[model samples]
Target: MKTFQEFGLEPKILRAITEMGFEESTPIQEKTIPLAMEGRDLIGQAQTGTGKTAAFGVPLIHKIAIQEERIVALIMCPTRELAIQVAEEIGKLGRFKGIRSLPIYGGQDIVKQIRALKKKPQIIIGTPGRLLDHINRKTIKLDDVQTVVLDEADEMLDMGFMDDIQSILKLVPAERHTMLFSATMPSNIQKLAQQFLRNPEHISVIPKQVSAPLIDQAYIELNERQKFEALSRLIDMESPDLAIIFGRTKRRVDELAEALQKRGYAAEGLHGDLSQNQRDNVMRKFRDGSIDVLVATDVAARGLDVSGVTHVINFDLPQDPESYVHRIGRTGRAGKEGTAWTFVTPREIDHLHLIEKVTRHKINKKPLPSIAEAIEGKQKMTAERILDAMQSDAYGEFKGVAIQLLEQYDSVNLIAAALKLLTGEKKEIEIELTPEEPMRARKKKFDVRSSGRRVGGYGSGGSSGGDRRNDRPGGGYGSSSGSNSRYPRKDGSNYGPRDGSSGSSYRGNSSSEGRSSSPRERDYGSGSRDRSKTTNNS
Candidate 1:
């Protein structure tokens, strides 16, 4: 890693970078900054959290002349959230130089963006759809644009934005700097680069294993009916400060979030069906620690950059290895150690293995945590809290009452009572989740001709095994299409019908069709008394 100052950055820019706590350049930044500054077209292949934003942002900001106010540079992203995030980072980098960047995206008032355009920002960061809209409406001009960046180019292709990107690129000046960044370079991306870039330098910073090395990866094999219980126990035992739970479909995200909240956990769901404002609120709460768990679909969580994410839980497996890499990449950022756990049904073991083989990282098997273990973990947490209070001398006011009780009862028993009161008994809530069909392992093939579809395998939306159009409302970019019938179960039995039918009931220790109250009452023993008997199979 090289220092930012070694890149010959302007003093003001270096000052801003230093203030932002960027002491050294990441691999992507070290390799990209010099080439990009030398006015060459380039393609950068790197995953999220690799500091790609700054890798491109620094040079873009450095090149901007504050005197020329009319959109000198344009950056196109796939999602509104990403557009906003990139704009904010660029804003910080350019603050000292008096260069301005404005973010334009859909789901916000176009009138407001048009007004902001009047202020003559030197840079424009926007989604492909909204950018093309502005182009057609003559609200934005690209005649004077000197630099163009396509951030997350592959993501835009997944969302069916290739044509829009082409149209936008055609409008830019013929002789100008162009840079494309993507996590994976599919045939479509390669063809696009060949057509648009003039012998661009290709730089790949992807690790041998796509997953971050700092992430401790593991998986638990259990039955479909046992997943919720397994997840609850893991959360109890791990007690992650902040966590993300990935689900396969919109319905799955909703059900899991609701079930988690019902169990007295602070959680919320993020998916495409949410309005922009609702999505913003959920992300805000998760970022501010008001909520500890975020349940999200793959597309909804795309390009999300939140710090302090301690854990990533795959309640349902991703559709492909790339998506798996993206899911875990949310945690273990900035050289911080994090944990990731995946729940695999017995039938889906081969699929999990497939992910492992492709990513070249072995996922260790973890036993399902017993209910008694969860209780013990809670007691440990309570003890830590008590010890912290003691160290802080915060128990001074309660010392008199403690002394009074100590005289009457054994000190150990009184301490146990305090732990019990602080660590409330686990709620015996019957959480019902819609069981997702297990994924089957299959070989992937790359298709170059398919620009509108996923190149190698199913899109994120296709993993739901239903109509992709219905999963994403408004037919917006980032909507993926595929059929679930491609892979059949090993038992020669097909998955449940996609029709909104209750395929099976996931009641306590039962996989029967209909719900039974008596079974749950019998299974949920009184106050963890019989919980030790609950095995992993249960």
Candidate 2:
């Protein structure tokens, strides 16, 4: 394995890597770095969390002269979250070398990005559609680009950005080195490579071996309506020390966080739109265990190294196999056992098979924990807590009080009452989450046969594509479908009215005054979806 220093990187890039706290090269980094530095067009098949960024980034940074401007390197990612994540990591890797990397994606202010363009960054990371937009506007000049990378190329293909990718490629110099990384290689991806790359060196890492062996993977078949309830029950049963819930989009993250909070869980949402300070605070609270659950989109949670994450729940299945691996990788770190549960809607089973094939692991199908099971799990935790207290001699002061209580009540009853108090029976919350357009299903070519019972967007009947929209609630973020975007949005920019406070409360109408029958309808139909239900007896 080659080290960063052995790869002949400049002192500034090494300093930046050291400052970022990385010492060892992950397998992809070790293999890809040497070839990338040699200026070979390379194709890397590696999983996320395997440090592929540094593999492509190090060489890209090395080739950029301090005086070069107008994007010496360009990276196109599938989503805004990923675009920002890659840009941030690339910036960190290139910081000391005077190599500036900027993230340009839809749903952010084109004007703001235009202004940033004026600063003349050396590297540009953007989603396909937005990058094309910048190209058309003449805001980004790719003539100086010496290298270009398509990170998570499969995802962009799945999101229908292939045409845009080709269009952007045409604007750049055809002589640049290109690195493409994807966990699964579809034929279309191969076609794109063939069209753009010049006899690339193929480096394929075995996918099944990439994931941590300690992580236990499972799936629960659930209908969309039962999802929130199932998640609540699962939390009661699992009692994770710390957990990260992955949602597919920004709206899903915001809704899940709000719903979890309403149910009295110490939870918060993290996405691309949050200021660095806000993202930092949420992360701090999560690392310190102040928050039991963190709801986040994939982009926002990238590069996170929190060690105590005991569980990972895929509230919504990701678009491709690579994202599934990345989501599950958050747990099962530091040689510790972890659990990952994905909620599969009946329609999304095919996509699940795709993930299983790419990961080469059979995810065991698990029954959803019922309300009773949740109660039992809580009681077990209480029992363990009591046993621990006894072992630790924590009852010295309470012994006399316990004796006094025993005299008034039967000892067994007193113990049962104590357990009941500690266990805390589960509370059912009726939460209405705003439904999102399910991710585009991969064409039949990517599907591989698997036996796991599937649900959600991976089910057999799942909706694949929808016209993209960017209107989201709160000051939170929205997923840009490679089109017009207004990003770095303020509290006032969203559809739902806000009072400009802590980011809650509807602006126009209260959720209490019965309005629309569904969350999506409420937003689009100018009404509200009340959690309160009125039953009618026939």
Give the true-structure RMSD of model 1. 14.3
| Alpha-carbon RMSD, each predicted model | 14.3, 11.1
Candidates' C-alpha lDDT: 0.75, 0.71
Candidate 2 stretches greater than 4 Å from native: 1-23, 45-50, 76-85, 95-98, 103-116, 126-139, 150-175, 180-200, 249-251, 273-281, 425-429, 444-538
- List clash counts for every candidate, in order: 1, 18
Q: After superposition, how far is residue 237 of candidate 1 from its true place, in Å?
A: 1.8
lDDT of 1 by residue, 351-415 (tens): 88878876779999989999888888788878888888888976778878878998999988888
Candidate 1, residue 468: CA error in Å?
A: 6.4
Q: Candidate 2: lDDT of 209? A: 59
Candidate 2 versus the native: TM-score?
A: 0.73
Q: How do the predictions measure up, each by TM-score?
A: 0.59, 0.73
Cα error, candidate 1, residue 285 (Å): 16
Query: Poorest 10 consecutive residues of model 2 by lDDT?
Result: 529-538
